[model samples]
Target: MLFPVALALIVFATSVLSGVFGMAGGLVLLGALLALMPVAAAIAVHGAVQTVANGARAWFSRAYIDWRSLGYICAGIGIAAALLLALRYRPDLATVCIVIGLTPLLVWIPRRWLALDASRPLHGVLCGIVGGGLNLAVGVAGPSIDIFFIRTAIDRRRIIATKAAAQVVSHLAKVVFYGGLVQAMTGADWWLVLVAAPFAILGTQAGYLLLQRLTDQRFREWTRWIVSVIGIFYLGRGLTLLLGA
Candidate 1:
């Protein structure tokens, strides 16, 4: 009872955070879910719920999407997905938690130095491979993918929309890859995904409305600090778990 209720709250809040800042929500969601369930189950559930949340965000911001970049990124994601299946990689919970917890810190990377050219298909593909693999492993690759978007020709709206679009594919791939692992779960687990996904959409809508009121610079400034704090938390928790193990 308490688990489902807590999950609902986490899903809503994190979705809003993703909606407003264009990322970070999944990191929080994964971190919280990890505490309540087995790593594989938590990842599978997160993948399913995030698939809906990102899909909704993409659809809502469909008009702003950058098609060319999205295409190349998708190609990369496909490759990564294929590679994952071939590898049969199954990460341990403590390691997965550390990776997820540290994800938000990618926000602070100096874009000026990296200047990843997303205009090139190879770059998008490269990001896709990295982001896609990371998504499967950790459940969210927003900050990793965000690095590719920085300094791109697309404006803020396009970045957010296109990234959301890319995430739709990323999360869906994650679900397909992780989905089979969860088939044995009780009906309650499916209920968690069903309930959490919709709440995530609602939270996203609320966040979108709030986003309209803020400037791009302001949005970046505010979300960065909050996400960093969350990153620190995951880092602490994950390390503690790993060491204790």
Candidate 2:
């Protein structure tokens, strides 16, 4: 009972954030899952689950996918995934926290000051590596990708679609790479996935509607503040875990 309820809340929250900000579901899911499962298993499961959710979203918004940008990003993600698998290395919790916490800050400078172009394949590849690697380590890949997209100045629908597409590929790659470790889902897990699916769909739809209602300037402002707040919280959490002070 508790598990189902928890899964629903997770899907709902992820949907709302993904919808409103055009990304973050994987990050939020990663953080929540880490508390409950082994980090590697959590990442594998989160990637598998989110692949389904994001795949659905990408289909729904198929009209807006930026194929050219996605091609480059997928290439980078593929390379990153291979590197991660080849190494089979896991970062310690403190290191994981710090890395996850700091990634957003590192990307922000180039995004805000350097005026990097998200539409560029190089940017997508870089974002993909960061996002994919972090997802493998900590289960959250949304922030870096979000920063990249936000910098690119894509409209709401396109932002949502393209992100969803990229995430779909990233998560699918993770699922495949980590397949040996992810045990078959128990009956209970499958049940949770089934129950969570519809809510995830509904939440994404709500997010799309919300995006349609907000003006471009308002959307940009909202995204910036939200990303900043999330980054600060991640940093604080990382510090607490790392320093234990």
lDDT of 1 by residue, 95-210 (tens): 77688667777789876778686668889998899898899887778578878877787766778788888888988888788877665566888898987878989888877777
Candidate 1: list runs displaced more than 4 Å.
Answer: none
- List TM-scores for all candidates, in order: 0.93, 0.86
lDDT of 2 by residue, 1-245 (tens): 78878888898778777777765565667677667766666666677678767877888889999888888788888888888878886646556556666666643454446544558978878878877776665666746776677567567778779888888888788767766665744566556667887778777777777777888778766766666666676677888987784
Superposed model 2: Cα runs more than 4 Å off? 106-112, 150-153, 183-187
Error of 1 at 205 (Å): 0.8
Error of 2 at 204 (Å): 1.0
Worst lDDT run of 10 residues, candidate 1, spans: 178-187
Strongest candidate by lDDT? 1
